[model samples]
Target: MSDASINASTVTTQTRVNEASFGDYFSLLKPRVMSLVVFTALVGLLAAPVPVHPFVGFCAILFIAIGGGASGALNMWWDADIDKVMKRTKGRPIPSGKVEAGEAMALGLALSGLSVIMLGLATNWFAGAFLGFTIFFYVVVYTMWLKRSTPQNIVIGGAAGAFPPVIGWVAATGSMTLEPWLMFALTFMWTPPHFWALALFMRSDYDDAGVPMLTVTHGRRATRWHILVYTALLALLAVGTAFSGIGGPIYLTVAVVMNALFLRGAWQIARRTEDDSEADNYKVERSFFKLSLLYLFLHFGAILAEALLKPYGLGGWS
Candidate 1:
């Protein structure tokens, strides 16, 4: 059999062996991550200070979510080999043999074309083009290239995730703005700390897969220091957004307190040593990881609240 045929046969055999389910295939899209993408993109669309038609707004966010999902599917397809080796990812659709890599690639590509075209038709060309670039960057640049090649993968590739707010803004205004770039910077700065926390605990998985995650290539001490530095920078950016009119007093308060806690956690992680056992050290890392998720969501949620409370004219447009 040819290599393609052999791969197909392997998937088939694994499916029969594991009795994988439909949810397995859906998991390829990384729905949890996509939900956050959708929510943040929606907030950006709604809070843009410029009004968009409700239906158009819905369609814009929908296409952006679809584009994010397409990126996830394509990532799984391309990273199947590494996914199979990583404990955190071994159960993913392609790796678990619930979805063929070819099937995933096709779905991802179809979604990519459909989302971009529909977004353009529904909203504007600017949003569609942005969505197209986000998909391409995530799948081709991040997953296929930077992921395996460099430790700076997340640093650069974080742009894919960061684009949604800007795209949402463009969908409404037909142009870019400083407000959306602030949002983008928030996510970009947050990515390293958020992901490095996971990497601290999951370093062995990347090592086994030969993926050049910072923790795998550099020592854990360096990874921890990087996380601390990025967390501090992320905090600065988050608070800075508040002063930029996209945020208000509520957001500023939340940003300050939340970032203080985040900073302390990062400091604790940095001060930890490799000699510490996984069970002991992982507590701080995992706590920071969970808090990191909440950090972004709550910040954006505060922005949404500020936008809604237009009575006080708190978010700048008086």
Candidate 2:
């Protein structure tokens, strides 16, 4: 190659390297997942017995969202290799070459520190400590360790996602309570089935990435059975929580209706033969996954509505 051609090629490559847009940085934060975190945290904060000042509540959520984003950045930094292999994750900032791995790591650590410190100052040390632990749990326990090592990774590692509501509760009340734990339980039990349903249809992604997802390690039949079992348990927890302090008639109605449909979906998935799945292109699995999204959001939304109705004396049963 000529010297000028080589220089131009190098310049083009360098330009590409330095051309990351705002969306690239935002993508590192995993905005979709962060939205769920923000909504659940807001529900927890609102449901707490103690009321937080509007500005303080806003600050708590902002820092919590930042902490969630930091965890995502760190996860992308570490999982860039596996991400490149997985079709669903190959478009992430690092794997797509839109952002450097080192840049992601630095952004993660910096944001982690800033979010925790600012949360402590804005709310209390208890909430700040929870946020710190949540970030550590997600980045270290789930991403670095369990995710590659075990098929049960989502089951246990789900605790990281489950912590947001508790952190929000503590931020508002400055203490722990059973209500927050109930909310935690709702998310915890829901994770395995939710992810497993995705794994059912996206089995190739996990297999390609060499992640030991239950669908990859245990076969689709076993994964389907596991989904049914967990879905039943999740239904029980969701219904039972309707009697808790956070629950009301609206929540109960949502729980009953959603769980019925969710259980039916689980049953369909559990009974599907391999031939049936292949014939339909795993449509049932895909539908179930979509329903699971609405399942959790509607449940949390009911909780938020109950909170909104509390001051008017219409939250729970009289």
Q: How would you encode candidate 1's per-residue C-alpha lDDT over 20-117 as one tens digit per residue? A: 46777677779998998898898788778789999889999999999899899999888888889989899787887667899889988899899999
Alpha-carbon TM-score of each model against the true structure? 0.92, 0.96
- lDDT accuracy of residue 208 in candidate 2: 88
Clashing pairs for predicted structure model 1, backbone only: none
lDDT of 2 at 130: 96
The digit string of per-residue lDDT tens for model 2 on 6-116 reads 999999998777678999998899999999999999999999999999999999999999999999999999999999999999888888877999999999999999999
lDDT of each: 0.87, 0.95
Off by over 4 Å in 1: 1-22, 277-281, 311-318
Model 2 CA deviation exceeding 4 Å by range? 1-9, 12-14
lDDT of 1 at 282: 84
